[model samples]
Target: MSHSLSRLPTLATAAVAAAIAAAEPAAASRAVQSRTVKINGVELFYREAGPSNAPTVLLLHGFPSSSHMFRNLIPQLSERYHVIAPDYPGFGYTVAPADFSYTFASIADLIDAFTQTIGVRQYTLFVQDYGGPVGFRLAVKHPERLQGLVIQNAVANVEGWSPDAVKQLAPFWKERNTETEKPIRALLTADTTRFQYEHGTTRPQNLSPDAWTMDQAGLDRPGNDAIQLDYFFDYQNNVAAYPAWGEFLKQKQPPTLIVWGRNDPFFTLKGVEYFRNLLPNATVHDYDAGHFALETYGDEIAAETLRFLDTLPDK
Candidate 1:
């Protein structure tokens, strides 16, 4: 009897150890994985996490940023969804060739190709800043592939433009001369890059220096400034397509979630209203953050995103 009782305790301990060993794989699976894939003749570096068969969330980053912008949010969402953030050409570790066209349309095409190359037929798009134009173009091209949209400070409405930015951008938009290029190029400075993450956050101290440092490193790459300038000049094309994007939203009525930082000096609250006008049922959450809301409110955004995804009919 004593032998059996001792054996039972040993068996129980073995089972407990086995259970922990089993759990480790799942825990390890949640860790973000970095990878690179060649798409459209350029090597596109991407961060991926979660199961391949799970509902996918494609994170499209903004200007002066890369997939690094979604670094914190990816792990949070990966627990329940497949999260992928790709660095577009001229950003992050993605290689940008001198001959490559740095227009939003070209970027959109690259992303679309990247998705197809990786076998992501359908997904929820998370867009911010430059991602607005790239993702919207993809949405317009392949409306059937979109499950939903999560827009963060991505503007499509005319009302969303800050007067100060519009005034400053007007001269650059109209002409590409040295005089016009000076102010636009000034925005590429380290101060402006840092300001993007620190400007309107409630707790600037909580912001990481690594965010701006990584972005500045990417921006500082040789010939990257000219690529940025080319894209800046081409931004008008995105503006021109806004009406079409709005029309697509009205026509398809894809489920949407808008999380905006009210203090964002670039795209304002007016842009959220424009989205609401299109996706009247879109859940809106405004934070007291700057352009890079994820820097300060990543947890909040991730929680809200999970909640929103859970409530989706297909998910």
Candidate 2:
């Protein structure tokens, strides 16, 4: 599941490309400039593109990934809208205090402060993986502020989970047990890169080695395993709250789009069905790609997202 560099951009190079591409075209461009906003005591790192006045689209990544996940898609969408992607605390360039609790609720709280600091009262949410729990917190709490919800390979329904995920993360579901934590940390190794890439995509040939390495580095970092372990523990709580989350979706029913990778080993295509059932008005697109469908299907996703935004009520 490795793609050559000549065909794809590395994380750092992709960031620069996004920025440069954004600056060249006044009409359609994306930049990779970064800004830090202090939320409580944590400083969140964010990258943005397009005109500030353009409609805002906030992109959220999953565990072990940063805003860099949207490196390709942002530039494409920046043509007609503003794209903002932020690194969740403890991942990417953002820093988290060693003692900080990395629960989803805490992360959600930080996102709330982050949006306010950026002066975006209303925005279209582009959430993936861990972004599901984090973004749902914002959607559930501030339903009025969301113009649309664009979900990419995330679980809103418990049925969407794969058996492998349940197996790998099962030990930590109830609470963090030291025995279960060891293998959880082991998955961060270089070997898991192939597993990660293959799980997320149908076309393993398209997976970029650098992307896998970037994510691996973050997971392999000192103390980072604790954050992931905490997230694993919090995810059980998220699973328990799934019913309430579905009810929230039914109640709020914001304009939504569900773009999923059928091959995603973690959040299975069942996740898309969950969103469809809850968001009866949702537009669902299941691609042959894997969990990181946006990476392989950025063009289609960007186009679909723009169309989804078009269907939203005027902000």
Candidate 3:
């Protein structure tokens, strides 16, 4: 059989001249844009993708991470949903005023202003790590504005915390001193940051070094350690709010979805049960991955998220 020149792979064929798709996974069809806005006296950096008119998915990142953490998942949903992932003050590219307080409540207030500034009236809140507390505060404050909730590797209960954090932070919450802050220092190290990405993931080889390296760079910024320490102490307030957040979930019951990494070092699978208890109807999916589950299973999680989002009643 004679093959046509067009069908053959050769140096002279046009196949090599055609536009080559990006080497990234097909989940990234929608181009993600990095944008910054001046709001609430702080410069907030966020990644935006998809049609502005489409349903919005507000992604709130976890501790020691910024909008960069959502890099993989944004493109997966951007084609059908308006996805916005922002760096909190003192995180990523966000620039906060010197006097700006870094407590979760304050950060939540700023984020509230951020949504109003950017005109996000309604959105599905996707929270991970430190995002759990921040997103909950927003949910409670504006229950009417939430289309739904997506909990990823974050917790509203004490059972979800890793022993290392609770052991150190619990005492710090009780009393902040050099003795209490010592272990806190260890948690903030670059080594610990790298460990977070590598510890429980199923495929370490597939994970990007950029994730933790970028996070460590953010953490290494001058005075960021103080901000992080403040967060460690402020987390006590979050623990106190669990009852109220639980009540909010029971009372509001916005359509809920829970996606988690069963092997996360910080947030245990047990913490997910808190939501399952409050939101019996909430959808749940867990993977063998770690805290940054999307790094390993973004496609699977995105497929699940698309299915769940499809079922929700539009605003």
Best by TM-score: 1
In model 1, which regions exceed 4 Å deviation?
none
> Which is the better candidate, 2 or 3, if ranked by TM-score?
3
lDDT of 2 by residue, 124-199 (tens): 9999989999898898889888989999988977678988778878776755677878778776677775566666
The TM-score of candidate 3 is: 0.90
- Candidates' TM-scores? 0.97, 0.87, 0.90
TM-score, ranked from best to worst: 1, 3, 2
Clashing pairs in 2: 19-31, 19-32, 22-29, 22-30, 28-79, 200-290, 200-291, 201-290
Q: In candidate 3, what are the lDDT values of residues 101-198, reduced to their tens digit?
A: 87999989988999999999999999999999999999999998999899999899888788876876888888899898988888889999999888
Q: Is candidate 1 or candidate 3 better by TM-score?
A: 1
Backbone clash total for model 3 is 0
Residue 270 lDDT, candidate 1, scale 0-100:
93
Model 2 segments more than 4 A misplaced: 1-29
Candidate 3 achieves a global lDDT of 0.88
lDDT of 1 by residue, 36-121 (tens): 99886899999999878888899999989999999899989989888899998999988897778889999999999999999999
